[model samples]
Target: MDTCALFHRYWALASESGYGDDLSGQIRRSHGRRPQHGSTANVYHGTFIPNGLEVAIKTFPSTLSGMGDGSEVLAGLKCIFREVHIWSKLRHENIVPMLGMSKDFECTISVISAWMPMGNAYDYVQNTNNDPRPLLRDIASGLGYLHGHELGPVVHGDLKGLNVLVSSDRRALLTDFGLASMNTSTFNMTVEAIRGGSYQWMAPELLDNCVATTESDVWAFGMTALELFTRAVPFPDCHSVANVVGSLILGRLPPRPTQESTQFRLTSTWWEICTSCWRRDPSRRPTVDEIAERVGRAMYDTAPASFTASSHAYAPTMDTMQSRLSFTGDGPRSAPITDNDNLLPCATLSGLADKILSLSFSPDGTQIASGSANGLICHWDVHRRAQVGPLSRGHQHWVRSVAFSPNGQWIASASYDGTVRTWDVHNGVQIGSSLQGHQGKVFSVAISPTGGGIASGSADKTIGLWDVQAGKQVCALVGHTDKVQSVSASQSRIFVSGSHDKTVRLWDARAREPVGRPFEGHTGMVWSVVFSPDGRQVVSSSQDGCLCVWDVRNSSRVRHRLEGHTDEVTSVAFSPCGRRLVSGSMDSNVFVWDAQSGARVGASLRGNAGWVRCVAFSPDDGRQIISGTEGGSICIWNERIH
Candidate 1:
């Protein structure tokens, strides 16, 4: 309602530099500072002497001006309306003010706003000796006003420390509405608009569905509070954006800064508000008004005298803050240093034919089950390092994936023959009739945490949830537009899938429906996806020659992208403790990466003689890494950090 009125008032002066009547000398970029990238535009520093206004100019790149003349450039036009019309009407001390806009004949749109010389809140906290209590209060006030504005409840789709600018007076003003969506209950942006920036501050629902609400804003506010206190990004414990999303989806909260770092002594009252704002159920999260009240009380309880409402007669100088500040840029923190050495082959089992598609260790750590290219399923005794029995008969085509049931009593296998089969572990005998329904190759299979359902992802671009006991399809999940490559069932009812579509998706076992928006980031086909032992994160291998760790709770963001393999990453698995990750690739190497930091734990394991098709961690601990090569030789490497 509020946005429409602003759009109507400025319709006559659309795309004109004099629309706001604040136009001054031609703004020129002279010694511009580092730019802050958004989904649509980049904000750069510029000065316009016409009004003596030191401002930041957000310029929309012409590339997004869709091909064709005038009207065809809908994206560019919408961005203009958002900044010049909607944002310009918003007037509040806590909200960044839009001064003017200019659109050239070349289709470049630029929106100018008064710049805050003190920098962003993140930098202020990092570089200044100033207390963050006032900044936090200012941020809360700004967010509250935006959510309850007289015009409309504008959902600031992207809220983080960088978007919260610090004025010369040490006040936080909410800025950057490039991702803002107005008058909509659910905000959905295109996939191209999803890149750039860490998603640590996004709410779970917003990450999963691209749907941002006022409640979601409250969630992000909580994250910003954590950032203020920690002087680090929210979910700093996570190694990647993918991991952060997984953690949120699984209801995992970021660790308290006080517990993890010695930077600040975070009080209990502040922590309480932070956790309350992160409640998984959006309905349970505190409203922005309620949050503002609580933050005010926290500030009062902590320091009452530091916060006083008034405008100084002269513009404040950046004396104390900028003098101590120094930074190149911001990104996901690096992994802690750990052991880095190539794993040596301790043993090798050689007997099978061509490529080994899948492998898994028994739950008890005594045995391993592997599916081969020729549809042969074999079992091995770990201690003896030998096959327990002869290869068993199964699917007519290649067996693409294999998994041991939670109880370790059965093994599930998916094959190119378009069927799923279960086999008893103790005896090489089929458990029941073939589970059929898929119209294309069944590439991956996973046993549910409850051991009740067996999930399979197939070339049909559908997911099948089958009842393990009945051996029948329960329901079909149709979401991925390309072939489904991998499936992993979390300890809970949630299951995740990777696809040739270059996306990962989450599904609820009980609801038989998709959970949230697809986790879209990979540029190549996703070959494998598996959940961590705790179900807080997911690891996926892709044809793009990298391993991606995604946060299961926050389904839309990729937390980490581990690159090193020379070719496609074929398989990925988590250690028993969920602290380490092992991946095999077409490069004939097996690599281990730290689950927390997304850092490669050690050098690539290099004893294999051919392309490494599959890898599995020993169920006992991560002491041993087992990998099966294209030539059907299973190499066992010791994973001790040396």
Candidate 2:
């Protein structure tokens, strides 16, 4: 059908069907003065005469008259023509429905659709407390529908958060088809062009001067996820375009958001899917159907309590929940081990000359290792509550953190001397010359679950993966801008790091690079990060006075931020079952929290007269909790339940 003929037929059909009067008559009655409305391409919100069904009218500017050859103007007209052509055929609930288009060259080339009152998804995240999973699902569904259409696969050249429009019913609709194209092959547009593309969301291949592909669309969807969760542009910290492209080439990603303003935070599964989309190899990117499935699973896993509410109904106020905020205590206080039922003081290792800085129970629970401020790493017999062997004393500076290898044969310790050393726990002898690389204080060390290597994070703003047997620095994972305070290795490939940069970052120790984006929610230095037993989640404590439990497999977002400590949280450890989290603080108390809900389980466990520097759950069965204090005391309390 011809363009003018099709337009006239569409208008006639609308008028006859009571969808307001014909386009020309409506324009005439309104005196050609359509109200300026929300726009993407000169689209104006207007009333349709008597019935007044709200509509958005997208018009092509007539300024093509003054330009020399009018090629620039010609391109815009072509874009409008393409939008109407492509949009008029799409009939999915998640896709914006086109009402009609006008081809009157005298006025302007225009296309019209239903006006979306809620505006873009990016804006919606900022103003609403509504859960965003449904919106993301809708976008993925719409994109999948377009790609799986019987005619041909359609490529949305641009699919950032801004391109997604939110309807009055809160349904997200994929709009702006200016750069879209139907293709039979994989990559559609082969022209080496950066024009009309969102650089921040563009795939690395596209940035490297390739064409738009279905895979590239998937990449943009991942970037859009970052925007929806973070409420900011991709790579918000990277100020220049050059830096963004450079980061992508070097395999860096946007930081995960830590905000609790939303009804549901992004899950670890969601983040895993998102990062997979941004993989450097475009061929490895997931299809739209796969994306939809992943998003569906994430929604099912992390659905909020308010998921069934109406669109207009906002999430309930969290003030009551906020009462459990960390730091709501009455000054500095202490509680005894016997305060709660079944609780007893199992053991106390006293008479140490210097304060204990770190504590770790061996895998078999037969021994406990304590790193002291006196540059000594002592192994104590857990059964007898006595020091067992000579101290592994080679570090010239205070030992900040310590961990026992999975096999319980070696102890890895981080020290202020800027070195990470592994020692034979059996003989209390230093394993080898200090594993040196960091130029500043080594604050934390974690032995891999395989016990083959140790990972250390230091004040030098780097994480070093060292081979324990070989005693050599393998690679330095450099990303954090501030001191790397704590490092925790998962059972397999991943490791998590918390830093003074106020972020928790995921890394692939095997690959020696960041896995996904850094978790960027803490307002103060993140002092500790620990993975759950299954390596599916991460728990981190910060000077910000919040303990954040993050889903590590899906999204790196802070799933729960437990509050109650008024002082800096020094250490956090997950129970063996991963159901509970124990945190020690400078407030001189140890608190336990429900990992899933971020709620306090009971009153704080207290005994230390000074700040609690470290904490560990007994590896045997979590029936006991051990804490190292600044006052040179190690307290072990038997767990009891009523």
Candidate 3:
């Protein structure tokens, strides 16, 4: 029979039998060698018949007869097809380019892609003298492209050294999209099927929730970096998967390699980057862009061989080593501010049991209240730089937010326990029973300027108006379609709420209804919101890494779009004078911006050991800026006017 006729016959037979053995045979395996085995698929070195070019043919086990139940086989086929569809659309130098596909392979399908002669990252790095920094940079660049794709962010469900292939030119290209997920409708794999990946590289949250996200991918990237550096899997000491899972659950990351290697040494700076990616809170994990920048800088700024295990031996440039001393006790408690244009580190406040998630200054600015992941709220005397009273403890879960009442006598705290509570600042004790109305975790709380009322945003997608004196919920303001992340009350009766739905809404407390059309501009979840000192404008920070200033009087009008942060802007606030804005981000840096022109005021303020969760300007005069970080320490900075 003719070649075209033979191809048609094989296609028909494969479709009928749910097998593609005849079609797959067209790509002859190189010397009939055994295929390289993987968790989901086996890759065979082969030559494409049509193009007469070398290629890698990846086949799944489900393509074979009797591999599993009919439904299971069907799911496997769907996953393979989904991967092909997604991979075909991606085009990047560091990402493996798709060639073609063989249909009905043995009863499933096979993916064809460019063959990498040098093999995977782990094997290549182990056998060759090639510096791994370039390969690491390639991986980061590829991952960043996938995340920042124009269509939608694609999450590589599994990222490990094995999935990174090195071409003949020693360029690392990311492969294995079988477990990837995209925001588009092309992804149809069941959560259970796609959730399973290499355990040692998985994020802690993924083990419990079984949901793969970009943040989880970042976690895996950190593990992949470890693998490339050590030439072994993550947690090499753990003999079994259960041990690795347990360690990750307890927030234990892979220990830093003590022994230095001639091939590549893991410096303290690189170790810091890896740990940042492994932060317990996924939202606090550094973005791929930030990772790429750091890795790129390290590649160019310092030679790998020059680094030593001793923290003091390697001295990176000031620009590269933005802040080697962390407030988390890694070094000196406070470092002198090196740049005149940046905020000067004046004091470092420590003692929180866990990461500080929220912070609020007293009306007089003499005291500060901080909420922690350990469910405790601590009061600090700003001048004394010490805890003022006993820790306030009532919430059973994470304290997400805290706010001081206008009178400076009471502090309102919102928690993940689905409750908001009031505490007496003087005694640091819960004043009443937990105020419970929301059906979900309360993320933020703001007291009215008069201190008589309180507003709270919750995961329930509803804003609660609470009567502080009565200690009860007054009404539920419903409008948001997703989790309400933040809420702020203006001097008037106006209140603003930002939600995961990617919109900001204004509410009139007196009427208990929305004031105008939702202020819509952000493309990601709104993480924080606050009103200007005059209450005429609203400032919001979002996961999109941009802040929006909305005119309260004209809700639909966005006054300014401030963009500088390279990662999720976790929190933002206006200076007491309302002339400037301060923002903290998962990038571990704080920035000051001109409130009027939406321009960055000075260099990024750096020192936080982890994600900066909350930033606030002193209500007294805005001369001091305090930022709380996921490292469980607070940094007080003197704002130097440029």
Candidate 4:
């Protein structure tokens, strides 16, 4: 129908229904006595003058009618037209049915619906003694109907606790559609108005790029469910909008509530469903139908025991006497392990004089290079599980980072002696003079995928780029306010650096400048950083005992936030297939995680005598994980162990 005809039809219906009476007087005499303010409209309790049937009158803001030109006013009218057209046709039990539209309110137009005495879903759950599972199921059912409409699917751009109202019968009904979109036609609303969603409940994709889809709505549903159960806003720890944006950019979901009463506790199955809805990949999220079915089943079943509590029940003690360890394995490059998999003792290579601080695997995966506190670099054979060559020594202080060349011919080491040097791996001799540019101690170094460029991060708050073939400093990029702790270079010559400033910055080696905004999620100093196999993602470890996986292509989107370590996470490395990650921590534990799901793979690998300082995955097969400890021991684990 045309816009003018639709408006006249609704206006005629309102006139016949006697909606022209003053709503303010009717609201003052009604049960609510005051108007309720929402993001898009103001709702007041009122009554139909003819039959005295109670109803709610929703009026748009008058500012929308006072734009610079008349075009904006016309657009506002068209928006109301579209919303009324869509909302009036919806007939599901969980959907708030539209009664009529009126022009007698303060704004140019108004919408009327059935009066919900129980208020919004958030208030209802907080004030009543009703079971939240039935409300959650009602919400899912309403969303499912909108998405599965036979005419054309509709996307509820805003799905949160505030948008759902509870009826007198305790049924949750979805209300506002100001930000919704219909597949048949587009609304004439401004971009700012359309993107006006609650930031805490928004999906990462929507926060990164302000485009809302059905998948994004699913993400909001998960946050809404969390709000109902916790009786608080999403991400309750975040204090402001900036903090919420930062958390969402880092793919950090709300941590499970620890103090919830037994009546409101979230079961393991329900939490799993919520996490599945918040997956980083939009296609991986479950459909509304699936969510409704899960909630329905959950309502009738007994609450299961906590899965997180049982996963960390056993902690192994340190054992240093074993020289060689073996385990039953499926094969090389087997599927990623699960929490049920058993962890066995692994081979231990000992002989270093002082603390082992750094580790790296050769491209062929046969040889491993490690740097120690006494400035000694040693090479080891994986199969033989012993030292391979004479120790290479030159630095005057502790060696902090080591990386192998692409061809496995040279090893680059960064030291606290304020220099970076390359050593010939085969003969244990220095390749060239030390590359000196930083005024402070160098903490980390990485070789580019092509093996021609080297990036070094130092305590001087600068990153030095060096030419490996020329053995000279190319340029120094300075931006960090604090010390740079770790650096990793990708195949495209682009690199990422984590700093003591508690931020992660991306740099283009060729351009010699920053790429985008610094990733700002970690609350503690960043300790380590590394790029995934495809160079599309970067995983960073921090002193906060957490790991964040970021999408390199878009700095605003973080793929996951891994939280299991009990102490400072010292190092992180991606497997060859990019499906798994290994991290070492000061807690003297090593953990393996599913890179995609951000779920802990199995029990923590224990037995390190002291703090774990470095970790790496085999470059060739990804089956072997090597970790070095402060007590001068290197352990190799087979992740495919049965």
Candidate with top TM-score is 3
Candidate number of the best lDDT: 3
For model 1, the local distance difference test gives 0.71
Give the higher-TM-score candidate: 1 or 4. Answer: 4
The window of 10 residues in a row where model 2 has the poorest summed lDDT is 316-325
- Candidate 3 residues 122-204, lDDT tens each? 88777433446667888998999999988799998989998999864346999998888788644334434467789999999
How do all the candidates rank in terms of TM-score, highest first?
3, 4, 2, 1
Candidate models: Cα lDDT each: 0.71, 0.72, 0.77, 0.76
- The C-alpha TM-scores of every prediction are 0.46, 0.46, 0.55, 0.47
* Off by more than 4 A, model 3: 1-352
Q: Which stretches of candidate 2 lie over 4 Å from their true place?
A: 1-352, 554-556
lDDT of 1 by residue, 391-499 (tens): 5676897788889998898899999889999998877798889999999889999998778899999988899999988879998999998789899888899999999
Model 4: lDDT of residue 565: 87
- Candidate 3: which pairs clash? 18-107, 19-106, 19-107, 20-104, 20-106
Quote model 4's TM-score.
Answer: 0.47
